[model samples]
Target: MDQTTAIIDLDLPGPRISRHVYGHFAEHLGRCIYGGFFVGEDSDVPNERGIRTDVVEALRALSIPNLRWPGGCFADDYHWRDGIGPRDQRPRMVNSHWGDVVEDNSFGTHEFMDLCELLGTDAYISGNVGSGSVAEMSEWIEYLTRADDSPMADLRRRNGRDEPWKVPFFGIGNEAWGCGGNLRVEQFASLARQYSTYVRNHAGNEVYRIAAGASDADLHWTEVLMQSFDALDRAEEADAPAGPFQAVSLHYYTMTGPWADKGSATEFSEDEWYLALERAGYMDQLLTRHGQVMDRYDPHRRVGLVVDEWGTWWNVEPGTNPGFLYQQNTLRDALVASVHLDAFHRHAERVVMANIAQTVNVLQAMLLTDPESGALVRTPSYHVFEMNTGHHDADSLDVHLQGVPTRTGEKSELPLVSASASTRGGTALVSLTNLDAQAGRTVVLDLRGRDVVGHSARVLSAPGLATHNTPEAPDAVAPVTLDAVRPHDRGLEVTLPAHSYVTVSLTLA
Candidate 1:
C-alpha cells in the first residue's frame, strides 16, 4: 500500500466545545468512598472531614471540570435526610445491591459540596426521585442552594455550612430506565416533570436540569424525552409556564466477551484486547445514533447531550468483592479513552458533557485508594485524562488521516490511529493515539492553515501490553516527556510507539 497523505484544513471555524462533558462520577460503591476519597480524620493519611488530602490534590492536578455524586443504583435508594447534621447523628443504611454492605451516610450533601470546592469543580447532584418524593427533591435543592432563611437553609446552617453551595448542575434521576425506577420513557417523562418542578434555582444561578435518558442506544427513550420537551415547550407557549430541560443523558460501557467470562485485568490474549478496543471504539457510533434521534425534534439544537456515565467494565481484581467493581488499567484502556474523547470532539456540536464512570476504586478509575495504608495511587486512565486536559473547552479543529485498521478474530478494521486537535490560549495542541499493539506508526500532522513554530511532546507507553499499576508499584504506568521535537516548515512529524498515547502542544506563530 502506498503512503497516503491526507490534508486537514482548519480554516473553517468550529463551535467552542464545553469542557464540562469531560466530567467524572463518584459513587458510594466499595472503597470509592469509604477507602477511596475518604480515609477518616483519625487515619494516618492527612484528611479534612474524613476526605484524604492526597486524593484531593491529585484530582485537582487533573483539572477535573465536574463530578457526579452518589449512586448508580444507589442513587435511587439514597435519601438526603440520612446524611446531614452531626456525623454521629447520621443514620446508617444497608447498601443492598452493592456488596450488601452498610452505608453510614458519612459522606453526604455537605461533604460532596466541600469536595467540589476543594477540587474547584462544579457539583452535579443527581436528585433522588425513585424512592423520594418531589417535596424531598425540592427540599434538597433548597437546602443546598437557597440563600433565604427557609427551613431547609436553616437546617443546613445547623449542620455546619451556613452559606449556600453553588450547585450549577442537577440530574433528575440516574438510569431511570434501569436501577433508578425501571420506569419506561412515558412513565419517566411524567416523573421527570414532577421532580424538576420542585428543583428551584436559588441565588439566581442557572441550574442545568438533565433528565434521565437511555441506558445505551435506546432510541425510544431519546425520542420520548425529546417529544416530552417539545410538548412541554408548546404548552409553555400556550401559558403553561414550563422550564426547559437543559440536557438529555446517555450511558454506555465498553465490555467485550461474555459478562461472565470478561477475561482478566492484567492478562489477556491479543485478540481479546483488540476486541475490547473495538468495543470502546463504538462511542463514535453511539454518539452518532443518539445525535440523529435528537436532531429530529431538536433541529435547532437547544438541548445538550450529556454522556454522564462511560468507561471500560472488566472483571474485578481477584479475591476482591465483586460489587467493588475494581479492575486494572493498561495501555489498552488509555487508548480506549483517547478514541472516546476524539469521538466526543467530532460531535462537540451536540455532545456537550461526559463523565467517566467512577473516579477511583471502580471501573476504569483515574485514582486508586488503599484504606488500610491510606495511600493513593494513579491509574493509566488518570494519565490519559491529564494529557488530554488541553482539549477541554478548546475549539475543535478538523483533522483527516488514512490508515489501515487493527483487526482481531472475525472483527477487523478498527481505526489504528485516532487524533483530535484544538487551539487554546494561542497554542495548538494535538493528541494522537496509536492503538495498534504490535506496530508503531509515524504520524505526519499537517498544519497548513494554522501556524506552527516550536513544539514539545509527551508520551505514555508501557514496556509490554500487560503492564499496569499495582498498589506497591503505583508509578509503573506514567507519562514521559520527549525533550527533542523540532517543527518542520510544513508541519510536525512524530514517531508514535506501539500501543502508545502521545500529546503534542505547538506554539502557533
Candidate 2:
C-alpha cells in the first residue's frame, strides 16, 4: 500500500487564520429560522427568547465566530422595520424565496441579536439594497449601534434595547447579480458603493461592511468590486476611515449535479461521492484565482475575501418543500466541510472569513431539529467543526503533501489525502481527511523545526459514506479516539481508515 506524507514546517508559519474563517450562515429560509433556531418563547422546547437552547448549545461547542443573518436572497427583499417593534404588531410578509410561506416577522432583528448573544458569536447583518432604500439601510445600522441621543437610537430605546448592540460585520447586499436584483456586475458595483456609504459606524461600534461578490468562477465580479475601492475605502483600524467596504463576499456550493437536478443527499453512488469532493476542492482554485485579481488592486491584501455562503447543496428530501432547500447531512458532507476548511487555511492570507450556508435544518447544517418529535440531532458535519475548534485564532502552518495517492474519477482524478495544520500557543493541530472509500492508508507527519513532546488524536468516520444521524440514531457517525497512532522519531504516524477525518493534537516544544 502506498503511504501519504504531509511535511509541516513548524518555524515557517503562515498568516493568522482568523477565527472568523470558521463562521456560520443562518438565513430566514425554510426551517432554518422558524423550526430550527427559533422555537418561539411559547414552544415546548427549551428556548431563550425564542432561540432554541439545544441549538445554541450545539453551536457554542464550536465557538462559532460570526453568523451572517437574514440573508441569501432574503436579505435583498427583507425590510428590517417590519421585523422590529412588538412581536404581535410586527407586520407579516411572504418569504417568496423559500417555501413561499407566510413570514410572521416573529424572528427579527432583536431575536437574531439575542441569538448571537446566546451563542457568543458576532453578527454579520446583510442589508436590503435591492428592494429597500439607502436611508432604510442607513437607519438600520444606526438603530443597532447608535447609543447617543439620535433619532434611530431613541427609537431603538423605545423598542426595548436601551444599549446598542455591536454589529461586527454588515453586508451591503447579497447576490446582486442574481436573487439580489438581477443587476449586471457594473450596475451592482455602483449600487454597492452607494448602499455601503450609508452603513456607518455609530458610537465607536465599527462595522465591517462587506459588498456582495461573485460565485463559482465569476472572476469579473470580483475584479469590478476590487476596482471600485479607492484610497479612502478601507476597513476599521486602517490609516483611513472605514470607507465603502472592508471586504468582498463570495458564494459557492458543492453539488455533484446541475442546478435543476442536484443529486440526492443520502442515496449516492461512488462516482457521486468522488465528484462531490472534487467540487468542494474547487474552492481552493476559486480563492487563488480571485486573490490574483484582488492582489492586482490591493497588493497589501487590505480587503478580505469573505465566503459567506458555502456548503453542499443537494436535492430536497422526498415529500419536502422543494424551495426550502432541506437536505440530509452525511459523512460525505463532513468530508466536504473538511475539504473547504483545508482550502481556507491554504489561503489564509487572503481568505479572512467564511460561513457555511444555513446553520440548522438547511444545506450542510450543524443540527437537524424535528420539533414534532422534540428531537435535536447533531449531524456528522457538526462533529468535524467541534473537533476543529482548536484551529480557531491559530497561526496557519505550511503543509506540503508528498507521495500522495489519487483516486480516478469519471473525468478527473482526486488526491486521496487532504490535510492542513495550525499552531496556537505551544500546541499544534494537524487535520487529515482520507477520501478513499474502501481502503485505509498510512500517513506520516513530517514535523520540522519543533519538538513534539506529547500527542493525541481523534477520528470521525462511519461504516458507509451515506451514514447519517437521526433523532433515533444520533451517534451513527461520530468522532472517536483513534488508537492506531504511533510515535516515530520524526513526528507521529496515524492509521487513517477509509472515508475518515482525523485530527492529531501535538504539544509542541
Candidate 3:
C-alpha cells in the first residue's frame, strides 16, 4: 500500500466541549461492589467507610469526572432506605436479575456519595422507578440534596454525614423500556413526568434531570420523548423546568460477529478483531442518527445526549464466575475505546456525558481488582482514558484523513487510521490509533493552518492483536515514548506503528 497522507483543516466551528462525557459507571453487580470497590472494612486491605482506600486513590488519579451509581438493573430493585444508618440494621435482598446474589445494602447512599467525594467526581444517580413510587424518587432527591433541619437532613446528619453533597446529575430511570420496566414509550414518558415532578432541588442547587432514553438507535423512542416534551410544554406553560429533559440517554455495546457468537476477550482471529473494530466504528452512525431525531425537536440543541452506558461486552474470562462479567482488555479494547472517544469528540456539540458500562469487574472495566490481595491492575481501557484526558474541556479541531480501509469484511470496513485533535492551553494534542495489524502508517498532519512548534508522541502497542495484560503481567500494555518529530513549516509527519495507539502533543508557537 502506498504511504497515504492527508491535509486536514485545523479550524473548526464547534464551541469548546465539556469533559463530563468521559465519566464512568459503577454498578452493584458481581464483584463490582463486594470485591471490587468494597472489600470489607475489616479485611486486610486498607479501607475507609467500607470502601477500599487504594481503589479510591487510584480512581482519583484518573481524574474521573463523574460516576453513575447503583445500577443498570440493580437500580430498579434497590431500596434507598435499606442502605442507610446502621450496617447491621440494613436489609438484605436478592439481586434477582444479576446472578441472584443477595444484596446486603451495606454499600448504599452514604457509601456511594463518599466514594464520589474521594474520587472528586460528580455523582449521576439513577433513581429506582420500576418497582418504586414517585414519592420514593422524590424522597431520594430530598435525602441526598435537601439541606437545613428537614427530616431527611436530620437522618443524614444522624448517619454521620453532616452536610448534603452536591448531586448535580440525576436519571429518571435506567433502560426504562427494558429491565427498568418494559414500558412503552408513552408509558415511560408519563412515568418520567410523574417521577421527575417531585425531585425538588433545594435553593441554589441546579440539578440536571435526564429522562430514560432510546435503546441503541431506536428512533421511535426518541420521537415519543420529543413529542411528550412538546406536549408537556403546552400543558404546563411557564411552570415547568427550563426544559422537560436536560438530556436524553442512549446505550450501545460493541460485540464481534453475532451477539451469541461474540469473539473471546483474550483469543480472537484477525478477522474477528477487525470485525470488532468495525462494530466499534458504528458509534459514528449511532450518534448521527440520534442527533438527527433530537435536532427536530431540540433544534437549538438545548438538551444534551448522555450515553450513560457504553463499552465492549465480550465473553467472560475463563474460570472466572460468568456472573462476575470479567474480561481481558487487549489492544482491541483500547482501539475500540479510542474510536469511540474520537466519535464522541466529533459530536461534542450534542454529546455531553458518557459512562463506560462500568468501572471495575464488569463489562469494559478500567480497573480490575484482586479479591485475594486487594491489588488493582489498570486495563488498556484505563490507559486510553488517561492518555486522552487532555482532550477534556478542550476545543476540538477539524481533522480529515485520506487513508485506505483498515479491514474489509462482509458487513463493514474501518479506516486504516482514526484521529481526533484538540487545542487546549496553547497546545495541540492529536490522538490517533491504527486499527490495521499488518503494517504501520505514516500520517502527515497538516498544521500550516494552525500554529504549532515541536511535537512529542506516546505510543501503546503490543507484540500482536492477542497480546494482553494478565494479573501476573500487568504492565504488558503500557505506553512508551516514541522518537521526537520536528514540526515542519507546513506540517508534521509521524509514523504510527501497526495495531498501535499513539497520542501526540504539540507545543503551539
Candidate 4:
C-alpha cells in the first residue's frame, strides 16, 4: 500500500511555548462544580477539601498550568459578596445563562481557590463588569489578593482563610457583546477601563488583566478593543502609562450548525463529521484574521490573544437541561481537540493561552463524573492533553508539513494529517492527527534541525468515531504505546491509524 508522504521540517523555530497554552476552564455551571469536580467536603466521593480526588490525580497528570473559573456568562452576573463568608449566610441565585437551577453559593471563592491550590494551578478569575459595579469588582480583587488589613481582606480572614491567594489572571468581563452585557464595542471598553482601574494590585501579585473579547468571528470587536486601549494609553501618558491588558480574550466552539439545532453529540452522520472537522480547522483562519486585526493596532504585540472558551458544543445529554451543555466526549471530539491545538501552537506568538470550555460534565469535557456512584472516567480528550504535555513551555518548532492528500467532500476538505512540533531542553515533541475518518496515514516525520538518538510515541483512538467511555467502561478509549515509532536518517517515522492522534517525544543529540 502506498502511503501519502508528509514532511516535517523542524529547522524553523517560532515563539517560546507558553505553559498557559494548555490551560483549562471550570465554570460555575452544570455538574462541573457541584457534582462533577467539587462534591462538597461531606461527600463520600473521596474528596480533598471538597475537590474530587480522582480529578485532581487526572489533571495533575497533564501538568495543568492554569484554570479559569466562575463564568463564561456567569462572571458578568456573579456578585462576589454573595459567594463569600459563611455558607449559611450566603445568598442563592439562579444560574440564568446555564440551567435556571438555583445556584447554591456553597462552592464560592474560598472553595475554588482551594481547588487551585490543591491542583497546583494558577487561577484565572473572570470578574463582573456588566451588572457589577466598579466597587464590587475592585473589592473582589482586594479580598482575594490583598494581604493587608483592608476591609475586604479582613472579611476574607473572618470567613476562613487568613493568608491571601495569588490571582494571576483576571478578566474584566466575558462575552461583552452578548451574554456578558449586550453592550456596544465602545460601551464595553469604557466599562472595562473603569472597572479595571478600581481593581487594585497588592501583595506583589501582578495580575494578568484580560479584557472580555469577541465571540467567534467578531474581528471588529478586537479592533475596537485595541483602539479603546490606545485611547487609554494616550490619556495616561502623564501618569506613567500602564499597559492596557496582558491579553484580549476570544471564544469559539465546534458544534453541528447553528444554535437552533446543534445536532446530537453521539448521533451523527459522515457529513456531520466532515462539518465538525471543518469547523475545527477554521480556528486557524480565526486566529490568522484576528491576529492581523490585532497587529494593525498592537504592532509590537504587547498584548496576546487569549481563547478563553472553546470546544465542541452539542445538544445536551438526553434528559438533561438544554442549557447545561453536558455532552459525551468521543473519538471525534479528540480530533477536534488536536485540530485546535495545532492552530494554537502555530500562532503561539499571538495566541498565548487557550482553555477548552467547561472541563467536566459539559461541552467536550475531559472527565465525565457521577457523584452518586463516585465514578470518574477520564475522557479521550483527557488523553490528548497528557500526550501533548511535551509542548508546555517548549520552544516552538515550525514544522512544515505537506504531501498528505486531502479528504474531499461536498462541503469540506481536510488534509489526511495535521501536525506541529516543539522542543524543550534536548527533546522535541511532534503531534500529528489523522483527521481522515477511514484511512490510516504513514507519515515520514522529518526532524530537520537535529539528529535524534531515540524516541517514544503514543496514539489515542478507538474502533469507531463515536467510540467513548462510560462510567461502566472507563478505559474504553485511552492511549496506547506505539511500537511503530522508528528512526529515519535524521528524523523519525510513524504510522497513524484512522481517526487517531499521535504524539512523539524525540531525544535529539
List the candidate 2 regions with Cα displacement exceeding 4 Å.
232-242
Q: lDDT (0-100) at residue 309 of candidate 2?
A: 94
Preferred candidate (TM-score higher): 1 or 4: 4
Q: Quantify all predictions' global Cα lDDT against the true fold.
A: 0.82, 0.91, 0.83, 0.84
* Model 3 Cα lDDT, one tens digit per residue, 1-509: 34555455555435565788789999988888888888777888889867888778878877899999898889998889999988999989998887888888989999999888888999999989898888888878888887898888888889998888899999989898999999899999888877877777874567898888988879999877877665333433534444555778999999885777566988888888888888888989999999998787766677788999999998888887777678878888999999999999999988999999889888898888877766788888888898988888999877877765556765666687898888876687888888888888878777755566567899988898877776788888988898844455458878888899999987876
lDDT, residue 408, model 3? 72
What TM-score does each of the candidates earn? 0.95, 0.98, 0.95, 0.96
Weakest 10 consecutive residues, lDDT, candidate 2? 232-241
Per-residue lDDT tens digits for candidate 1, residues 85-162, read 888999999998789998999889988998899899999999887888889988898999888799999999988988
Q: What TM-score does candidate 4 get on C-alpha atoms?
A: 0.96
User: Which candidate leads in TM-score?
Assistant: 2
Regions more than 4 Å wrong, model 3: 6-13, 231-242, 484-486
Model 3, 504: alpha-carbon shift in Å? 0.6
Off by over 4 Å in 1: 1-6, 231-242, 404-412, 483-489
Candidate 3 residue-wise lDDT at 317: 82
Query: Alpha carbon lDDT of residue 199, candidate 2?
Result: 90
